[model samples]
Target chain A: MPHLRWARALGASALLAVLLASAACGGGAQPSSGGNSSGLQVIKIATQSPLSGDESVQGIALKNGAALKLKQEYDQFKAMGFDLQLDPQDDKGDPNTGVANAQKLAADSQVLAVVGHLDSGVMIPSEAQYHAAQLPIVSPANTNPNVTSQYKYPEISRICGRDDVQGPVGAIFAKDQLGVKTVFVIDNITAYGTGVANAFKQKAQEIGLQVVGSQSIDKSETDYSNVLTQIQQVKPDLVYYGGLYQGFALMLNQAAVRGIHTKWMGPDGVFSNGLVATAKENAIGVYATSVAAPTNLTPGGQKFIQDYTAEYKENPDPYAIYGYDAMGVVLQGLKDAIQKNGGKLPTRAQVRDAIRAITDYQGALVKVGFDSIGDNIYAGYYVYQITSANASTTGDAKLMAQYNPKGELVSQ
Target chain B: MSSTLQTLPQLVLDGLVVGFVYALIAVGYTMVYGVLKLINFAHGDVFMVGAFVGTEVLRALTAGGRPLSPWALLLAAVVAAAAVTALLGAGIERVAYRPLRQAPTLILLVSAIGVSFLLEDLVRLVESIHLGKFVLPVPTVFATVYRIHVAGLQNPLTIRLNSIVVVVASILMMVGLTLFVGRTRPGKAMRAVAEDRTTAALQGIDVNAIIALTFLVGSGMGGAAGALFATQYTLVTPYMGFDIGIKAFTAAVVGGIGNIPGAFLGGILLGVLEQVGGGFIGTKFQNVVAFAILVLVLVLLPSGLLGERVQEGA
Candidate 1:
């Protein structure tokens, strides 16, 4: 009886967590999805994102970015005797909402591909639904290694770099550019943070940089002084934080208060306007490595910035070019599949296979190429230093260096 | 000296700031349990709501770079949050707990959990609609940092101005509440109700009003704590309350469920122990240390440190 009471209590608390979690998801619109496909053999691109909640800013940008690309490719698809239309779904950033959106997309016979779901946790679970429907989905911003490596869901392909590669890219830059020798690592104890931190640590050691210490902190914890104290005691040359912008910003704020000024670097998770907004001046000189290059860094991406700005009338979030690139990859698959089908509309399976078989397909920011596991073989990482300008503009982080997937220096 | 030993003073100082916050939230739990003999599980969410409201107020006041003293801004935030959360606490008691007063303990617990979830979701929905963000970066109130140079350590023991305010404010609330319960008429009525509801009614005390007042004061304290916590920590989310609430509840239990001073003592002790113990063990085990102390206290002193003053209600 007591155990039952405990079970009921636990269940109640779990329900509470679910309610809170669900309330935080987003949903959005635009002429909306499922529009008339010009009366031709319709090809639908479904987008999943939290279109309406706190994450809507990023999610809507992703959807709009993908939409802009799909809209531009519409005439080409129409000329090929097929109709191209976008179907945007608000996954609301909740797993349940994302899965529901996935199910809806799966049921649409015309829908052949998906372009989003900003959070990795949301997208990873939705993969099954997408895979079951024989619908290939391309991730725009997910950096988790498991995105491609987990189920190796051939239906899932991502245009962004993975967490493992992003971490080592920072280490490579540290040694080559900053001449970093000694380092300390810190993580938020979550899967993403721990994975990135560990990768950075392993790569740092592999490259002969002495790793003086490592520590994990709880993300929910407000006070990080205990860990900061540990960092003070260790006195490493540089500290690498593998966490989101919020936690890293807090650490930077606390470190400044403590007068513990060692060079600090973090993975892509720390690259955001929120970081600059939260930590302000402390964010200056902080090094971060991102899977996606700054939108203006490449010629193709520079064009995307202009087109996207002209289209949306606002500068795109960092995820916009990624969304553009992802949808571009999907459109490429549709083209290959249709051509292989002798200019006829291809089955979803054919399109999926065509996507997987991509050997070299260059997009706006990245050259799209998928290995068997749906990872872009040519995915490159960019290292950025937050400047005073970055504090005002959303994605104005100064590009410091670029690295190949193998951690070899590509550009500086 | 060992590195950790040199780090001890800084760690303790950091822990004490958080400990005071825990004490503030714990007093809410202890007071409610003292009078009503119910856990009021939604108390944490109430604290979270206070934080959001406080942040919003601060944001509004400071909009367009308004020139305002940090202390005045903090006062405005704290006052607004306390007023809003007090009303919420009373409303919750009236709607969620009053009708279920005679229900089984398990049922009351379930209701409490339901109320907790409802508050979290409601705040989330409201925040999303109003501010478009459930996670808010609280405007900084105090930017000054004080560095204390010690004899042995190379790095100064750095303390944030906001942290001192958090400690001082919590102490004021704790002492004020103690004096109220010990020296006032309404406070005596509250004590009488806790002692024996029927007897208190016979003694011409408005038992229901007293119970509601207890919730008002307790929840007000929680709101002030939330505001202080927001300023100290710098960011607040809808679910931030759950973690801190659980910790405060543990502090409440460890300090003696119905005892005020016990909650304060327990909170301070738990905070320091968690930091000190976490230093010895892995940092990941910091939570383990807090809960381990709870388990140890429950096993050795089931009644808690100051002892649950069920009849005392102070």
Candidate 2:
């Protein structure tokens, strides 16, 4: 009994230590007011993303994009008499962690604006804290419609199209372009996946495509042969999956093994090089829709891709350009605020207002401007097909068609 | 066949294939519990380590588009994973568990959980340093070369060659394990130690050696399961072991903890129930059904279907 008591004490103490350490890390705010004698004040632009765990590949790409943009503008900003710094935080793709990161960023007085919280689930919970702190936040990747819905957090904005807009595009494309009459829809049961899949299913039914079967799969599940078997029975012409890359890869690989060769389509969640790498040859012919056009399409996009590749020595992922543009929006807002305030350091509130007032700003990915509710007015979705399944190349996702916010497919 | 009947064969096949993998991993949990009365929570991470080892080996052998047979690559992967994980299991026991063998059960369990986290983070750190990322795709040596379709089914009921290989290899391993436990001297010593460590030691059996051997065998099976799992899934991540480990542990409990045959039966039952229930009911409730079965089994039959009643204070 005494030994048991001692063991319990040790375990409890160890757990308490871990909790305390994490709390200290999450809640600590460094004093940022120690200015250099040269009268230049340090201002931080924090970026939040999952820098660890399964989705770190996408998050790291986002971080690299922001860091590259800051590097390019660091000296130019310094020349304008402001010491600019980028403080990147890892939210681990978790809502709790994202909230903690938001609190930490909000506590820092010098942090003017934020660049991310890539996932919508993370953004949904954490945006309120930033709103309360009056810190303007822009996301390059968050696509859930409710993230910037009317009457919600007006301080939050994203360059990406909402899932409600993007999901219907996939359904319409499958119905019109691919000519698939019947489809099986699957979701991973997460908030984002469920929302996207529901939108797709609703649109498919509305457009007269038979919704043969719909199923929810746990994201942790690697095997889906049983569900695939059920799908084969329905004999759907196409399968629409609403989940991230890992689940998509697993389902695609397992479906291939089961010889269920129906055409596969997914939303922006599956638009990543990681999917092709994981799914390999099975990824061939799979279709996905994204919130931004390909980096090779426009001249600005082409230059951004070339510079990003040369700097990072790797091709940028789909969300990388969004990260670059998100940072650009913040920097442009800061410049505008400074110019309006006669070369003095503007307050956080002024920066937030400046970001909201911006119009007709050109980004590397698109001509970006925020409308009411902080949503990108020009943001739309594009359809892509995996032409090749090579891991080394830029995912080999060739752009097949583009769809505007109205769900009309446009020829480039 | 009607649509309802058409799905039956495919569901059963799917369940059985996954069941075999779970059964293999569950054996490790059951065997370790049998000897030490301690749950090696790190067993799952050992399985993950096996998967990574298998992936690295296959990648190295097949680099530069080398032409190697699929069977050969699979064999090499399984063997390498098993060998490495066997060493890792023994090392974990020596460093983390053996020191606290005389300690309270709480201490042993806590140590196990600590080791589990340590191993997972350790793998993540090492992989990040070496491969620049924690998640890596396992290269498949052989595609799904053959598909078996059942006749008389209106909707095609197809099974891949990899599924057949997984099932057959699992059966062979189970049979070999049964023979080893039944006939071999070391295996008999292991059983004796499990029955009563003090008495087995007094009767001249090497208690420590038998315990070590139990860990080696159990961890080796876990490694083999991991290798097979990677081959089927075609992706490996540092966190993959946790979910599967919990499921397999649940399988061990449902079948009657500390019973090898019970673990096997429990795994198959859980797998079949999950697949069939998910197919019929809602897929969101698949995990719920599996855990509900565990609870019902524990409540109704405390000793499990095949497990013996535990003699308190034996």
Give the candidate number with the greatest DockQ.
1
What fraction of the reference interface contacts is present in each model, in order?
Answer: 0.67, 0.80
* lDDT value, residue A18 of candidate 2: 81
Residue-pair clashes per prediction, in order, are 8, 0
Residue lDDT tens for model 2, B189-298: 98988899999999999888888899999999999999988887778888889998998998898888888989998888888877777766667787787678678888
Candidate 1, residues B204-286: lDDT per residue as tens digits? 99988999999999998898889889998888888888888999999999999888899999889888888887776767788
Worst 10 residues of 2 chain A by lDDT: A25-34
Model 1 per-residue lDDT tens digits across residues A181-222: 999999887667788889999999999999988889976666
Worst 10 residues of 1 chain A by lDDT: A24-33
Question: Which lDDT values do the candidates have, in the order given?
Answer: 0.84, 0.85
lDDT of 2 at A243: 84
